[model samples]
Target chain A: MTSFGNEPLFLGIDGGGSKCRAVLYRKDSGIIGEGLAGPANPVQGLERAQDAVLACASAALSDAGLSQSQLGHLIVGAGLAGVNAPRTRAAMLSWQHPFAQFYLTTDLHIASLGAHDGTDGAVIITGTGSSGFSQCAGQQRFLGGHGFPLGDKAGGAWLGLAAVQAALLALDNLGPATSLSQAVLAKTHSQDSTALMDQFCGQPSAPYGQLAALVFDEAAKGDAVAKAIVADGAGYLSNMVLQLTELGPIKVAFIGGLGGIWQPWLSDAAKARITPALQGPEVGAVIYAQQRYTGEHAP
Target chain B: MTSFGNEPLFLGIDGGGSKCRAVLYRKDSGIIGEGLAGPANPVQGLERAQDAVLACASAALSDAGLSQSQLGHLIVGAGLAGVNAPRTRAAMLSWQHPFAQFYLTTDLHIASLGAHDGTDGAVIITGTGSSGFSQCAGQQRFLGGHGFPLGDKAGGAWLGLAAVQAALLALDNLGPATSLSQAVLAKTHSQDSTALMDQFCGQPSAPYGQLAALVFDEAAKGDAVAKAIVADGAGYLSNMVLQLTELGPIKVAFIGGLGGIWQPWLSDAAKARITPALQGPEVGAVIYAQQRYTGEHAP
Candidate 1:
């Protein structure tokens, strides 16, 4: 066993809209413990995010058989959602963390790093929201993480919104009735258009994301409306991939809940650039910490 | 001047998402007074809507040189937005109103009544939201009006959302840059995609509805993206008109802020069935009160 004074311990955190994850690690032994907690997106709630970050970090220390007092002895690196906004970033940077050292970055940056195992590459994320990010020759580019109703085309929430729109049109007899519409009605437990509208009225993107699977399933079964919706979303993602590729020769890795599902629908050129992710964003956070620490401590 | 006791005073109220309008009427004097107040949609706030209703009514009485106590003698007919929702309707119905008799119905219903001067007809409304309503042969039919994001296609908010989506795509280099995109960026004071996204993040339908005029202006200037957006929305509105016409031989009257802007884009078939509205929704509420009072007193 490495003594506390002889070897430094690291904690890596990946925080997002729905949940926060932390991994405790050592250079010699790799991952020693893992932790999970609720939402940690600063844009949603700065106080809640801070609480979640501390909770996950504490859980990670406990998981590694360490005491909470050891927080001051450990270095921490965090990749958090919504930190791309300058205000949110500033707010997060002001957190009075309990770590010996703490580093922060946007979730997309860490995600790209993790996809390429701390090397330069591109990543397309299609979870509840959609976005593309790349780092090549120390230059970074970001595209299409605009959120639901305004942007985020090809993301889960976008797909769900498209499905609901089509289903409603069909129900109103303004558009053709299809199996996709039927499935949407069934999945939402809505007997008619009014009920379906009631289900989504003034709702956020999460609930819409939950309905995404219905689109893929119906499209796979040859529903024209579903196929059209999928094609439109996939087309946008494919264009995003092409746009990202223009930045550098970096291989692109797809990540997030709907990432794998979108693979088959991408253009041949987009598919050609696809690669498997080497690690998760938590590992990317650790890599970020190591790089920052080395650069700051260099002679 | 008709004495209040000799000629019963009738108050008609048209309460919508943004404002409430009241008209004081009598058979001998016609419209004698008018009043207006803000945001009276019960779905947004029951208490606020109730207060606005009373405020508008009090203003109408004051305009007509009547005391506040005269409310107890005035028969009121109200056509309110959001009363279509059963729960909101029930809550509104439960209010201990000060009027002698209060009859409540949906804004769409009153609009249709006023458009046809209490005769049977169909009406299409395209404001911040969209909907179609027709009353013919003692049967009523309603369409669209599902609200923003989920539905409300062809409405101001829907048109604005489509424009923003196109603008973001153009900014990201995934779609062609056009005058529509340029206008959106300029109107929102956004320098780039990030800034544009920031401007609309978590915004409600009202802000988006404000952008509708941009689409119309760009489309008029022959911008392809804007034209396409307008075409899609106009197609939906035309389809809505066709669907409403299927119910009966009723002439359809287009109403609301964007109603006239959408006229030139509608199909010839839709255009053939269009007619000018004879009166506003507040007058429809008066007609409703007259019908109800006459029916009750007839035997």
Candidate 2:
């Protein structure tokens, strides 16, 4: 394989629990190709994640009309879920790769960098789980990304779990009856808590998280229980964002599948601080790769 | 297979999720023999539950100096968990048995009867789950006992889940920090919500319910979060009991492993209506068997 005369080809990858995406770029040519593949999170398995990344990159290469041997001329950066763990990161870093150079970081980290043009800022992610990160003055403060039943107060799983709990309370007439309870009962085909528990307890976190969208829908229609849950969740997120401001006047971006759904619920002060992200995590990966590759070449 | 003419031999069995207990009695004598076996809840498996009940009864017979051949001389009554489900009850009723006569009822049904001396009264079972039953004026009213994450407001699982949720909020500085959070973190050896969620989410309801004792213990020592959880639970139970009173002035007994633990938290009005149980579900099973056998004999 020969270097393409310092044309500086780049492959940027964003790998998450749901999917892996790659964007291939050439300096001054912008994005030349893009590819998509199945889930590539490390928790799924090192081999599976690697295969996903390779397949996505290969597709991007094909899209760019490039050959396999050209891989040796490319700089690569990956922002992936479950890469925050030391063991996972170390394993990926040590793995054999054909790229000219490789850069690795968390999906959250890349999203934050991209949100603020690679400068200091904060981001709150409320997808299947919830968490927030604020970087300022060369220091970072993290909050609320703990996962379901722990810190994901306003996250999808938390919302669904809380909704189920409330529905049970309503069924017993221990709390006010609401339409939210009826909806859950209908979905589960359960007339009471015993049926509901027997059916739902054995399921993993995803089914519970899926119910969160229904809750938000009910809240929009003026269901008291759903409204209360949404308000409580919003309160938690608002407090988190307000605390981010204490570190510095950094722009805060809400980023995640559920982030846009919750945007209207955030406090006015928090909403005022919010800014649109300039690009997706994949673009962030590209920018990150460019910066790191340039720094190495400068010296 | 011959009868012990005019001599009544009684076997009362209480089958629950954890274990099965059998007591043998001769008409003129009090408890003459006792035996124990493993969990006999039919939900676990009809075969396994049946085997547990048989093993427990056989042990009691051995203690009473009876051979397997003497099974035909005994009249057996069982109050078993999962028998409340019609399918389980019908299956057990239809199964072959060697006893001279056999009667079946739910653990909750017999618990109510035993607690109130075979008379009209009520019982709220607050063990790993919560459920209430009131039998008065020849009618029965059932409430709450929906199992974890659905019902069981003041039940162990609910308390533990609430404690974990609180600990995460405390960790995020979104809520008051308390000793309960410290205790949970210490027990799970989890430093953050992510670690805690990964550890706790996979576990079944029992482990979560077990942590409830810790929450109550913390509340006793004045942990604000613990106190709030306990109070919220008590509020739910209070509402349940008050609704039960709407039927009439019936005596109420709290039953099960965790029943006594929550007694002190009952409201004064609720406490005033409370009464000590006359006997346990096993004894109630014996009494029920005697009544049925005598009624059969008369005609």
Judging by DockQ against the true structure, name the best candidate. 1
lDDT of 2 at A13: 91
Best by lDDT: 1
Q: Encode model 1's per-residue lDDT on A1-299: one tens digit a residue.
A: 23366366888899998999999989988998899999999988999999998999989888888877877877888999888788889999998888888889988888988889999999999999999998899888889988887888888889998889899999889999999889998898999988898899899998999989989999899999999999998899888888888878888999999989999998998899999999999999888888888888898
Clashes of each: 0, 4
Residue pairs clashing, model 1: none
lDDT of 1 by residue, B136-255 (tens): 998888899888888889888898898899999998898989989989988989898778888888898988999999999999999999999999998998898898988789899999
Residue-by-residue lDDT tens digits, candidate 2, A1-299:
22356577999999988899999988778898899999888866888888898889988888888887777878998888877767789988887978888898888777888788788888888888888887888787777665555457898988888888888778767788899999888877887767877776656567788889999999999999999999999999898888876789898889887989999998998898888877888888887888788888896
Candidate 1, residue A53: lDDT? 86
Best by TM-score: 1
Runs off by more than 4 Å, candidate 2:
A1-8, A44-47, A63-65, A68-74, A91-102, A187-195, A295-297, B1-8, B70-74, B87-102, B187-195, B291-298
| Superposed Cα deviation of residue A76, candidate 2 (Å) | 3.4
Q: Give the TM-score of candidate 2.
A: 0.89
lDDT of 2 at A271: 92
TM-score of chain B of each: 0.97, 0.92
